[model samples]
Target: MDAGAGRIGRALGPGRRRRERPEVTLTNYEAVYDFYGPGRRRDGFTHPLLTFVGALYAPEVRIRPETVTELHRLHDAGVGIIVAANHPSHHDPFVLASAVYDRRVRFLASGTGLTKDPLFRGPLRPVFEYTGTVPVFRAKNYEGTERAVHDAAAARLIGLCVDRLTAGGVVLTFVEGTNSSADDLRTLRLDSVKKGVGQMVRGVRDTGGRVAVLPIGIVYRGRELAKLPPRRPVVSAGPLALWEDPGPAPSVDEVRHAVRAGIDDALTDAWG
Candidate 1:
């Protein structure tokens, strides 16, 4: 039917007590975030990894921001950026990752691809893990009776996303729930978006963190992967998901519709 996506990542914080122990003097996440700070260019998916991923998978993903003024402005704020894009290829994450040439970016990576699959167990595993890519297991693939199990897994990953988002991070995701069939590899399916994204925006706003949901559309022409495409990423972030201060947590269906409309508009802009 469709492909997969990440649920929430692991939630970071204290134990059940939920108290900050000043005596401890440091946090596990603080060390982690520090390692992946602005100067962490050399650690994770550095320039070398981008080259490798491009050469092997998506060669078309080069960051020549034609009109990403607002996009960069949001990134400079140090809050969090939700880069919502369409999934037309398995190389979507790598393509989006390239856009952050001068900054850092994280994404909801497929757990199966990163762990169970042969392609990721070797060199790619370490790179993705280091670069802040949270691996998510799609419970929907289990189909019928296994929904509850997948829900738990998804919640954990989402908890992790909430913390990182409020703490200033850049996340790339395919809200369409699966890959599209534009390349003839799969059907161009844009069924619907999961509600985790909406919750993230609301959660961040509730905590007083400024979050921007930039609707990014990725378009591919023909079925070639090696040769560069005529058009690249389109950055038309105008009417964001939460433009002003969010009032209440919107319904899942409402957020889903907004996400679709925004992505559709961005895609139209990219094509023209």
Candidate 2:
């Protein structure tokens, strides 16, 4: 057998036929918006599955009690929350979910997770689909008209996030836009914050409501950072920074700075 077939055989084990790959077309943003919009049914399976996976992989996940209490207070106040977290490993999502298991939250994730390689398609993609993750197509990944289309899609995702916030839901976003290695994690500093987060906050403010930006920092401790199922993981939550609609709108840079500072604070707490 060829190397590719041999690998597939190993993944499937001795006598099983290969599962047929689904035809995943890149649909327009309108379709994506409608699918995850307010009227969509709540998922009954994904959360439990995520918690299970997190337990199995990151059994030593640690989170502060104060963080939990803060989250409760914000939710009790009926404020929309935007969780801005630093991305250290792919395991960060599962770790964050396990940390904040009490709250129903949606993630703002890359569209590539939907159409990427086998690892993503086989196991991870379904989690994104079922968990109401807003898939964002990075314009840099495309060219010409395709880039323009994807850019528009990314913009539409912001509006979808605003809708979620306006309806009193929590949205978790990785402000760095990509993952960093454990070696880099030692510094405990966030990478450049993305502008999309600011856009979502601004959109929510435009609709006149109370919104809170909650920053979370995730730290992974393991010999092999790239290995599946990370080792001990630590999560820290900074105080919720509230923004009310009546004040002057925050500039994108201002929002980025706030999120950056918040994540840094969380990182310090996580290391402590």
Candidate 3:
């Protein structure tokens, strides 16, 4: 009974995911990962090995160096950058990270998927953490719990990290919060912008650091992965949204529109 499962079992009634576990047995995931021994199939927990393999085998499945150069230029600007992008596929984070190569960027990930899967919980979870992914807890919590147990104050905490790296670094946020189904803009799903971006902006201002947002749009030539290798993905980097005020962040709609437009341009130029 890991703390999370125990918490879930106690709170979600008798017949739930945790009910499958024996009454007294606990889920010691660290031990499970140790037993499994890091393997190539598990990309979530395996760290350096997995990262190296992913880069080697999928070298062609990456962002272009030109895109990376533009990203570096934004870093050279000395403003904190929040990469608000659309999630068109499962490899979205990899696409973003490949372009960001070597930059100190952190990703705010949805906690639901990573924590729930046995595979991720066991052999592949470290890769998730090592890549600067701090999962955001979105589940509704039991009484007396202010926020979801897994994600309380996550946004605030990540905001602080952004502040600490204020001079230059990337904070990748999928404005939709999930993968979009089509080229058209999807409804922004993370709710309206919360205090996270605002807190980061204030921290940067107080420290005399600058803050900006880069809307990076990624488009798959054929969206469908079952298709041939003829369709290479394209990423478009838009102009930065430099913060002029230390107040609330841009609404999700605003970021979505910007990213969509950028992707449109990038896709048109890449294959046309």
lDDT: which candidate is best? 2
**Model 2, 205-236: lDDT tens per residue?**
88886788888778764532666666567777
The C-alpha stretches of model 1 lying farther than 4 A from their native spots are 1-45, 51-67, 102-123, 140-145, 181-190, 224-239, 243-246
Whole-model lDDT, candidate 3?
A: 0.46
TM for every model, in the order presented, reads 0.63, 0.75, 0.53
Clashing pairs in 2: none
Clashing pairs in 1: 8-157, 8-158, 9-156, 9-157, 9-158, 181-186, 181-187, 181-188
Better of 1 and 3 by TM-score: 1
Displacement of the residue 211 alpha carbon in candidate 3, Å: 1.6
- True-vs-predicted CA distance for residue 267, candidate 2, Å: 1.3
lDDT of 1 at 183: 40
Residues 20-67, candidate 1: write the lDDT tens digits. 211111113343323322222234345577656544443333222533
Q: For model 3, how does the per-residue alpha-carbon lDDT over 1-272 read when each residue is reduced to its tens digit? A: 67987888878877754323111111232333332222112335434543454363242222456655554565666556666665666666555555443333212121101111222445655555444454443333223554443343444444444554474655566655555655333322334234444454555655666666665566665653433222345555555556645555555455444555554554444444
In model 1, state the lDDT of residue 156: 52
Model 2 CA RMSD to the hidden true structure, in angstroms: 9.6
Error of 3 at 232 (Å): 3.0
Task: Give candidate 3's error at residue 177 in angstroms.
Answer: 1.2
